[model samples]
Target: MEKLYQVALTMVEGVGSIMFRQLINNFGSAENVFKAKTDKLLKTPGVGKQIAEGLKNKNLFAEAEKLLNEVEKQQVKLFFSTDKDYPSRLKSLYDAPSILYYKGKADINSVRTIGIVGTRQATDYGKQITEEIVAQLKPYNICVISGLAYGIDIAAHKAALDNNIPTIGVMASGLDIVYPAQHQKYAEQMLEHGGILSESPLGMKPIRNLFIARNRIIAGLSDIVIVIESAAKGGAMVTAEFANNYHHEVFAVPGSLTNKYSEGCNKLIKDNKANIFTSVNDIIESMNWDTEGKVPEKNTTRNTEIDLSQYTQEEGQVIAFLRTNGETQIDTLSWQTQIPVNRLASLLLNLEFQGIIKALAGKKFGLKL
Candidate 1:
C-alpha cells in the first residue's frame, strides 16, 4: 500500500480535509485523483474551484511525501478512518478525523474507553475528585482519554498510570509538537503506558481552532466523557457538547457553587447534557455501565466504629447534617449544624478525604448510600 498511500498524499495544501475526503469518494483513491481529469474532480461533492485550483499542480504530493518521511523518521504511526486500529466509536462521528498520527504503545483497540477532561487551572477539589474516579476506572481495562493540558488532564493520566490503566492524550497540535510544555515528562511517561494522538501533521502548532477540533476526537474516541472541572465556558464543556452530539454519555462531578471551575459542569447537568455524579458509582450507574465486574464499588462497603465520642465536633456536625438532611449543602452544615465556617471547611475536606460522604456541586454534601 506504499504507492496507494493516497490519503496522506491528499492531505497536502489546496486539498484540505473536506475536499480531500470528497475527492477520495469521487475517485476512489488518491492515485485515481491524480489520474483523473479536471472535470472528474469537479463532479465530486464539495470539491470545486479551490480544490481543483489546488491540485492544478500535480507535483503537490511533494509536501505529502515529506510528511510521510517525517512520520517514519519520528517513528509515528498514522491511522486512517476505517483502519482496523481506528477507534470504532470515533469512526461513527460525523466529524471524525480523516487521519490521525500516533506515537507510543497504547493498543488503541482497548475493550472500552472513557474521556476525562477539564480546566487548566483545576482546583484541589477537582484534582481529588479526578484522581479518585480514575482510580475507580482502573480495573475495567478501559483506556482513559484526555487533552494533555494541566490540572484534571494530568491528574487523570497519573491516576490511570498509577492504576495500570492505559491512557491516550489527544492533542490540538502535531505529534511532533507538545502544547503546554510542562507536560513533557508526563507525555514521555504516557508513551510507556499509553500513547499521544493528533490529527494534524508534524510541526503544526496548537491554535484555538485546533483545540475545538481536538475535542471532537476526545468525545468520539470514548463511550463517555467525564468532566473533572470547567469554567462557565471552556474546552471541557465543548467536549461535553461534542459527546452529546456524538450520542455518547457525559458525566460531571458537581463542585461548589461558589467555585468558578464548577459552573460549566452545573450548566451541563442542568442542560441535561451530562449526568450528575457524586461518586464513581454514580457515573457508572447513571450510564447503565455494569460496574459489578468492572471494579469493586469502593465506598459502598463501609466499615465504622459505632462510637461518636472519638469524633471531633466538626466531624460530628458533618455526620449529623448528612443524616438529617439526607443531602445538604456544606453551607447549611455550618448554619444548621452550628459549626464554624473555618472548622467546617477543614472537617468536610477531611471527611471527603475519608470517603464518608460524597460532595456534589454547589458545595452540597450527601450521605454515602
Candidate 2:
C-alpha cells in the first residue's frame, strides 16, 4: 500500500521528482504526503496550491492501484526512493527519482560502474572505440552502464556482453516499452547479465523530455561518464553535463575538429569539462584499480610494516588489494578476490572496525593513510 502511494505521487500533476522527494522527506512517507493538509502542503518547500490540490485528487489512488497491479503482473520491481534496494548512487542526487521500475538483476551498487554515452548516430569510429575500450575494461570487472539508445549505447552493451561483463541499460520509457523498438532484442539479451531501469511508469511514452531527464540517471549510476562520440548537441553531452555537476569524473574521446559527430567531445575537452579519454588504461589508472590483485610494494604507509600473518587470508588479501589500488570499491574487491558480496561486505565492516582499513564513499575501501 505504501508502495502504491509512492507510485501515485509520481503521477500527480506538477509534482516533479525533486518536489516529491522533499515532500516525502518532510512528511516521512508518500502516503503521508497525500494525507497532508493543504496548509501543511503549503508549508512544504516547493509545494504550491496547484500541486497541493493535485495531491488531494482521489483519482490518483485508482491509477496508482492499476499501475501497481500491472507492475506486479509484469514482474517489474517497484523500488521507492527510500527502499533499501534502490540504487545508492542515484539516491545521492537531489533530483533522484521517487520511484524506479527495473527488470532483470544486477548489483546496482557495483563499485566499478562506468557509463558509456554518445550520440544516437554513432559512426564507425565511435563504435570501434567503444568496443575496444569495453574489451580492455573487461579484465577489471567494470559494469558498463548506458542509456540503451541506438548506436554507441548498444555498442557498449554488446561489447560488455561479448567480454562477459555486466552491463545496465537505462531507459527513458517504461520497461514494457522499448524505444526505437528494434533494440528490444538487445535489451532482452542484456537482462542475462544486466538490467533495464527507468523512472517512468508503465505505458509512459518515450517523450523527448523524458530522454533528457533519464540522462541524469545514466550520469548518477556511474563512477565515470565516457563520451565516445557526440554531435555539437545531443543526449550524450547532456549526460556529461549532469555527470560533471554530480562531481563524477567525465571523459571524452577526441576526434577530428572537422567531424560533426566529434564536436561535442572536442568541445568538452576544450572546455576542460572532461578529460581526454584515450584508452582503457586511462580509466584504470585514473580510478587506481587493482587489475591483477597485486599490492603496490611502494605504499608502505601506516601499518604496512605490521605483520598480516595475524589476519585471516581473506583479510590479508583485502589489505593487499587496497594497498595496491590505493582506494578500491568493495564490490571490485569482492570480484577480484572471488569473495561473495555478502561475505566481503561483512569482512569490510570487520576490517573497518578493526582499524585495518577505512570505508570510503561509494562503498569503497582504502588503507588508512
Best by lDDT: 2
Error of 1 at 117 (Å): 0.7
Cα lDDT tens digits, model 1, 182-258, are 88888899999999999888999999999999998898777778998999899999999987766567888888899
Score each candidate by Cα lDDT.
0.76, 0.85
Give per-residue lDDT, candidate 1, residue 345: 76
> Residue 218 lDDT in model 1?
91
lDDT of 2 by residue, 297-345 (tens): 5454555675779889998888877776677655446656778767988
Q: In order, what is each prediction's RMSD in angstroms?
A: 17.0, 8.3
Name the top TM-score candidate: 2
| Each model's total of backbone clashes | 2, 1
Evaluate residue 194 in candidate 2 and report its C-alpha lDDT on the 0 to 100 scale: 87
